[model samples]
Structures are given as C-alpha cells and as structure tokens.
Target chain A: MISLAGRDILHAWGKFVFTGVGLGLLIGVTLTMAGVYRGMVDDAKALLDNSGADLWVVQKDTLGPYAESSSIYDDVYRGILGMPGVERAANVTYLTMQVRRGESDVRAMVVGVVPGGPGEPGQPGYLVAGRRITRGHYEAVADIATGFQLGEQIQIRRNLYTVVGLTRRMVSSSGDPMVFIPLKDAQEAQFLKDNDAIVQQRRRTAENPAFNRPGVPGLLNAAIASQSANPYVNAVLVQIEPGYSPDDVAEPIRRWKRLQVYTREQMEKILVGKLIATSARQIGMFLVILAIVSAAIVAFIIYTLTLGKVREIAVLKLIGTRNRTIAFMILQQAVGLGVIGFVVGKISATFWAPIFPKYVLLEPGDAARGFVAVVVICVLASVLAIRAALKVDPAEAIGG
Target chain B: MLTKGIRINGLKKRYGKGETAVDALKGVDMQVAPGEVVGLIGPSGSGKSTLLKCLGAVIEPTAGQMTLGDEVIYDDGWKISDLRALRRDKIGFVFQAPYLIPFLDVTDNIALLPMLAGHPNNESRQRALELLKALDVAHRARAMPSHLSGGEQQRVAIARALINRPPVILADEPTAPLDSERALAVIRILNQMARQYETAVIVVTHDEKIVPTFRRIYHIRDGRTNEEAGEGRAFE
Candidate 1:
C-alpha cells in the first residue's frame, strides 16, 4: 500500500522541515541542560582525580575541604606521615576567590600546596607548560582554564605570584579553575587578618598586663609575633602505600590522629552525592518540564495537521479505509517529525557545547537515551490526533 | 426477480428519536443494472443524498433489502458481517468535488482502492493505468491532484471509482463543479466505464445539462422515487 503519511510530508515538506527545525532547537536546549548536569558531576570527579589523593584528612567531624569549611593545624600532616601504610601526606588548603591578572580578575579556587615535585599528593599531577613550583613563596601553577600564561603575574590577596606553570582540567568541585600557590601564602591568605588589623591586635596584646611582667621582658614581643602569623591549613591529602588499602590506612589516621578521614569512595560520595546533589535535582526538574513542553508541542502540531486533513480523512473513511490505517498515518507523521528534530538537535548541541562557560560533556549514552525518549514522546503525543482521526464519520463525505 | 447488478427494496432511514424524529428516507426503492448508468435527481430537501448514503453503506437503513450481484447485503438489518469489507470490495464512490487525496499523484489516487483491498501493487497500478488510458487521462498519470485541471481530476476520480471493479458505483454530483461540456464529458465517461466494467452506476446531480444523457432516471421527491425516461445518449 502507498504510504499516505510519506506522500503528505513530501507534498508539504517545507512545513515539516521548518517545524522540525523549531522543535529541534528546543530539543537542543534540553540536551544541553542534561550535559550541564553531567559536566558538574564530571568536574567534581576531576577535582578528586587531579588531586592525586587516596584519602582526605580534615578537621574532626566535618564534611570539609570541598563541601564545607575545614581548619586543622598546619603541622598535622607531619604526624600523619609516620603512620604505617602512609606513603606520603601533604598539607593542602583551598580558598575560592577572584584572582587578579593585569586589569581583570577570574574566579579561581586558590590551592596551597608545599613546594613539592610532581609526586606529591596535593600538587598538580602534570603541567602542560612551564615547570612546577620550586620556589617556596610567590610562585604559582595555574590551570589553563584560568587564562593565565607562563611567566604571567597574578595577585592572590595581599601578594603577587608569578604563574610558573599551567595545567588542564585542574578545577575545584565548583568548576572554578585551580591556581596553585605555596602553602604558607595560602595559610596567610586564608587565615591572617590585614596588616592594619594585625597592628591594632598587637597593640591591644601589649596593653594587657598578663604578658607585660618586668621579669619576662621578651615574652610580650614573642606573643605579639605569634599573633601576627597564621598556623592553620584546610586539609591534608594522604597517599597510601601500594600494598595497603585506603580504608586500612584511613582508619588508623581517624583513630590515632583524632581527625576526620575519608577513603576515595567516601570522598567521591561526598562530592557527587552531597555537594552537587541539589544542582542535579534542579537540572532534573528542568528536564521534566522540557519533556512535557516537547510532548505538548508535538501533540499540538500533530493534532493541527490531522485536523487540516479532516476532509481527506472523511473521504478515506467513506471509501472503506480502516481506522487503523488512518491512525497509522498520523503516527508515522509524528515519528517522522521527531526523527528530523533529533538529528538537528544532536548537531546543534555538538556545535554549541564548547562555547559554554563551563564544560558541557555530551556523552553518546545520553544521546541514545534522548533519541529513545523523543521517539516515545512522539508516539504518545500522536494519540490525540489519532483519536480525532478515528472518530471521523464516513457519512461526512456525503453531505446533505 | 432479483438482479445481479444492484437493487434496493423499501429502503428507509430516520434521524433522532421521539418528537424530534425525522424520516429522511420514508421508503426508497430503485434498481440499476450492470452496463448501465442512471441519474438520481431531486430538489434540495428530497431524499437523494439520504438514499445515496444508504446505497453506499455509509449509513445504516431503518428497514430495507439492499442487494449487490446475487447477495442480499441488507434485509431489514445488514446480512454482511463486515460492512467495511463489503464497502471496499463490492461498492465504489465518487463525490461532488472529485475529493481525490491531494497528497498522492493521479496514478496512486486511482490505484489506492485496489491496494486497500489487498491487490498487488504492480497489478493495481496496471489496472489503474488501463482505466486512466480508457478515460483519456493517461498523459497526466504522474501529476498530483492539485496540478490537474477540474475535468482531468474528475476523470481521475472516475478511474479511481472503477479501479476495484466493484459491482456498483454511487456517484454523488460527480459533475456539479464542471461546465456544460465537461459535465457531459463526465457523464459520457461514467456510462463508458459502467458498460466496460459491467458495473451499475447511480449518479446524484441537479445539473440540467447532463440529466438528459441517462437512459433511465429516478426523480426523488419527499422520500419517494419516480422513474422517468431520459433523452439517452445526447452527448453528440
């Protein structure tokens, strides 16, 4: 039998093509929304992966470092390094703030790591350009996403650091690019008050008589020096020995060190399941709304197309056309529209993904699911048109 | 005696119920033989459309016996199990406006009926082409309905009606949209197709120009039919 739907589409292909283009743009936005959610999860994983840590040691009883604020003494990692199954542990601090470059500033996750080589757990794994930081102060390794080049100088808070290296995909859980500075600079940046406030604090400390005894002449100066410096870090990144499991090492640190310890799996859960869970739900709500809107648009378009052919449909029915044939014709047209829209949508999403501010990871698996979903939606959307076509009376063809 | 063409005995149809009931077709009796074309003429309120719908099996009759060939299709109630199949295989229809499917070309429009009845695609198109040639529309076989002239479209419509070779064809105002010459041409094509296919035809029209071409005509007034003689073969 001749395909009634195909012939109709060919006869008015301009209409179908234009409508499909419009619907395809909507599908593209829907796909991009899903990709955004995927990108958030990937960024969180990349943050953990690039840190090169087998475990996270933070302040006791806190989620810390990524999802919450964590403060521990700067000397904590030294104690953790001597434990059995502990290959290496390094002090690390994270502070999300805008870093200035020349005239403009870019949002970045300012990380503080010891002036260690590539093997350190908290240091950036590899640099795409220039050398890793070998200087103890005022040297930085910046993620390429921060738009910093080799030898470029950037200001972290009160001090300026030279961007000595650049790495890729080194971002925080929030998708901000990481700018690696020396541990001491980050401690002062995160904890120390301004110079004016420090001077005022020192003056106040001297006025207190408790530390001003005549027998202890240098005691007040020592107390003032201590008050002017910062001695805290955010967390310690630990790497277990090759023969040992992360849980095996992490448990001892939790008990003996009296600090919160998280294995790799637990940290992943904290980042994905807890940190970005709300964003995932928000994206999910947008997906549901987009799906409903797509379904409704398809239904309206199909229903309108069917009504336009009411006269032909009545004549078909009068000429002994079966209800199923009429219904199938409408269904074929709807699915055809969906197929065209999906092709355009996939192409549109691919072309525009890179230009987005954050990474938009369009996985093949998501495309497959989106195609199936579009087909199912088209089938369901055709129901209203099919019902209307089936209800047409053959007698309408022979009017009184 | 019952004929092998088509005959209706005491056909009746009503609309609504109780006080709002309407007896549109009080009782319609008519006969058209194979190899013959007859006209059904009436005023606006007459039962011509009502009887045409009944004969086409598009609407059920209140009480009647409708026969096609040697089969009693309706006796008070329908005797056929599948009315749709009966309509597809045993009857054909033409409408006032040609009403060809606009999406399809001339050939597929004519061939659609036989295809719907499960005929092979090549065979149906072959039959359709032969009818198109016979109706002098073979040159426009691939043209879509929208591209065809009114007279050409009507000829295609006639080819479509005859494509399935059904025993009976009910044409409602098949030439109403045409001028005098095209109208006569349509009536001539109907007569030729009816005789060539051995199918009976009943045309419902108010066109005075082509009314005299029929050898027999049925004039319906107030749900009753009166047989009259036409000026037969007045085409020349």
Candidate 2:
C-alpha cells in the first residue's frame, strides 16, 4: 500500500519542514553539549601525550602537578637519571596564570622545561612555527591556541619573554593553552616576589638582629640571598628505556627518593578520572535533561499531530484500516522529524565548535551513538501519539 | 425471497443497567430492496443515530436480526466474526459533511475502502476511477479534499461510499450542508446510483428541501419509528 504518512507529510510539507527545522536546532544544542564534554577529556589526554613522558615523579603523597599541587627539589632528577633502565629525566613545573601580550592577557598554563631539543621529556614534541626554546631564560614556545605569534613579547610574572615558536594541541587538563619557557624563568615566575617584597624581606631580616648585631652583617645578607631563590620544581618527567617498564622506573623513585611517582596509566586516571570528573558528570546531567526534553517535545508534537487528524483516523478505521497501519503512520512521521533534527544538529555542532573558546572535540563515535539515541528516542516518543490514535472512535466517522 | 439488499427485524439497544437503564432503540424493523433509495427522517433526541450505529455494526444491539442479501449478519449476537471486515465489505457510508480523508487525494480517498478489502492496487484504483466518472468527479480525481470545492468533495465522498459495491449504504444527512438546488441534485444522484448499482440506500436527514423526493420514508421520535409514503416529487 502507499505510505499514508509520507503522503500526509507531503500534503502539509511546509508545516513539517518548519517543525523539523525547529526540532533540529534543539538536537544541535544537545549534540554540541556532548562535543564539549568530549573536548574536555581530549584536552586532558593531549596534555599527557604532549608531555612525552612515561612516568611522573612529584612531591610525596600528592596526586599530581595537574590535578593537585606538587613540589619537588629541582635536583631530584639527577638522582633519578643514575638509576638503571632510566632513559631520560627532566624537571618540569606547571603554573596556570594570566600571561600578558601588549595590553591584553590570556589565561595559559606556563610550563617550565629544562633546555633540551625536541622529543625530550617535558618539551613540546613538535612545532607549527618557529623553533623550540633554545635559550635558558627569555625564549618561549606557545601553543597556537594562545593566539601568540613568533617574535611577540609576552610577560610572565615580572619578566618579559619573546614567543620563539608555536605548537598545537598542547593544553593543560583545564584546557588552557601551554606556553613552554626555560625551567629557571618558570621557577622564578612561579616563586619569585616583586622588588618591593624582596626589599621588605631584607629589612625585616637585618632588623631582627638574630644573625646581624652589627657584627654579623654578611651573615644576614647571606641568609637573605638563599631565601630569594627557588630551587624546587613541580614534577619530574621520566622517559623509560624500550625494555624497561614505567612501573619499574617509578617504583624506585617512590621508594628511595621518598617522592610520589605515577606511571602513564596512573596519571591518566588522575587527569580524567579525578581532575575533570565533576565536569563530566555535570555534562552527563545536561545530556539526560536534554534527552528528556527532546523526548517530551517529540511526544507532544506527535500527539498534537495525531489529534488534528482524528476525523480522518476515524474514517480510516471505519474503512477497516488495521491498527498497525495507523500506528505506523504516526511512528514514521516522528522518526522523520528526528532524522531532520539530527542532520541539523550535527551540522550546527561542526560549524560552531571552532568558535567556542575552549577546544571542542567532536568524535565520530559519539556522533554515531547520538544518532542511534535520537532514533530510539523518536520511537519511544511516538508511543503517546500512537495510543491516542488507536483509541479514536471509528463511529465518529458515521456521526450522530 | 431474500434479495441482495439490507433487512432488519426486532432490533433493540439498551444503555446502562438496572434502575438507570434506558432503551435507546425500543424495537426497530426496517428493510430496503436492492436498487432502492429510502429516507429515514427523525427529530432530535430520537433513536436515528443509535439505529444507524447498530446498522453500521459500530455497536452491537441487545437483541436484533439483520441480514445483507441471504447472509445473516446479526441475530441476538454478531453472526460475523469481524464486524470491521463486514462493514468494509458489505456497507458504505456518506456523512453530512464529505468527511473525506484530508490527507488523501480524491482518487485515493475513494479507493481506500476497496484497498482495505484486499483488492490489488491497480484494480482498486480502477474501481475508484470508474466510480468517480459515474459521479461526474473524474476531472478532480487527483485533487486533495482541501483543494476541492464543497460540492466536488461531496461527490468524492459519494464515490468513496460506493467504491466497495456494498449491498447497503447509510447516508447520515448527506445533503444537510447544501443549498436547495444542490440538495435536490444530490438526492437525484443518490436515486440514480442506487438503481444503477442495485444497492440499497438509507438517508437520514432533517433537511426539508429533499424530503418530498422520497417515495418511502421512516420518521423516528423518542426511540421509535413510524413508516410513511412521500410525494416522490421529481427533481427539477
């Protein structure tokens, strides 16, 4: 038999198309929400991947430099390097702060890395432009997401550094673009106080007379000099040799060095499972609410559409149209609306993801799952309309 | 002898139970020979609608005997297994308004009954086309009900009723929405179609415009009917 639903839709195509477009926009928002959550997880994973480390050694009993605050003596990597099966070890510091360029500031993760060529642990592995930070103090490699251009000067704490190179997809677990500077500069930016605070500290020490009684002038100055410097790093990034497992290298650091060491798997758990777990749950709750709203809208639309055709339905019933045929008509229309909405939503998400300030990763697998969910939702949503249609009195066609 | 028409005897329908029981149809007896057109006229609150429902098999009667041709359709209880199929195969109906399926084109609207009865697509459509031609609505066969004029939609509705070649047709105020000229024209067409198809037709209406055209009529009031002969005035 001819498709009654198709014919009806064609008969009132203007209404159907307009309604479908409206529903499509809602679906688009739903899809975009899913993309945002996926982007957060991707940013966390990319942070780990770009670090190029097999293990992370941080302060004792701390989660990580990413998920939590960690502090370790900068020289601890020297002890880690002498261990067997250790390929390379480097000290890295992470400080998330506002970095200024000219008049404006951008929130970025400032990474302090030991001077090494590309492929070294704690260094940006690749560049989209310029070169790596070859200098010890003034040169920087900024992630492209920071909107930084080569040869541009940016302020990190009290010192100004020039952006020497650019990288892509290097972000913190919080989705801030990474700016790689030399270890010394990053440590100073992280721990150094202003000139006023330093002067105030010196005066406070000289006036105390604990070390200076006009007899120990040099002793107080020497004590103040040591306090002015920062010799601590946030974490040690370790690269294991081909035959050595990350657990093997990390176990000794945890045992002998008295520091916290995490394998790649453990760090990932910290970043994804703990660092951004609450955000993921929040997005999940939004998805559930959107799904319920979508289902309810579809049910209401289908039910109204069915009610509008009560007379025709009665006529069909009087003419011996089977209950299934009538039910199928309503079902097909609901699915048709969902399909229209899905296409609109997918297109909208793709077009707008880039405009979002944070990275928005839209995975193919997520889209596929989304499509199936929409179809299932449409099928379930059509139930209310189907029941109402089935209950229509065929005798209405005969009249009183 | 039993003919290829509709017959009814001692039909009764009661609503509710015990102290609140009300008999909508006390005892209804009616018949229409094949190729005959008859009128069923009644005032408001009468049992006309209830009897029509019973005759259309939309509702079961408390006690009744009804036959189409030689087949017993209802006797105390339903003799037919599927009343829906029985209605589709053996009965046709034309409402006060066209009540055409709004989603369907004129041709499909008429063809729907035959299609529902398991006839092949081409054959059912051909049957519908022939009826449209007979009803002088062949030119608008492809038009949607919304696109058609009021009179044209009524013609399509009539074609839909006759598409199954049913032995009995129940027309509930088929001309109630028409002007005097159109009302007489519709009655004339109904009479002509009945004689051509050898089908029995019963028109229920309170319209006075076409009342005189019927040679036989059944007037119903307060759950009862009284038979009467009309003037049988010819349509101008």
* Candidate number with greatest DockQ: 1
lDDT of 2 by residue, B35-83 (tens): 8888999987798999999999888999979999889999999999988
A110-214 per-residue lDDT for model 1 (tens digits): 999999889898899998999999988999999999999999999988899998999999998878999999999998888668778887988888899987777
Compared with the true structure, what per-residue lDDT tens digits does model 2 show for residues A42-127? 99999999999999999998997898899989899999998878899999999999999989999999999987898899999899
| Candidate 1: regions farther than 4 A off | none
Q: Report the Cα lDDT for residue B195, model 1.
A: 85
- lDDT (C-alpha, whole model) for all candidates: 0.91, 0.89
Give the residue spans of candidate 2 off by over 4 A.
A213-217
Tell me chain A's TM-score in each of the predictions: 0.97, 0.98
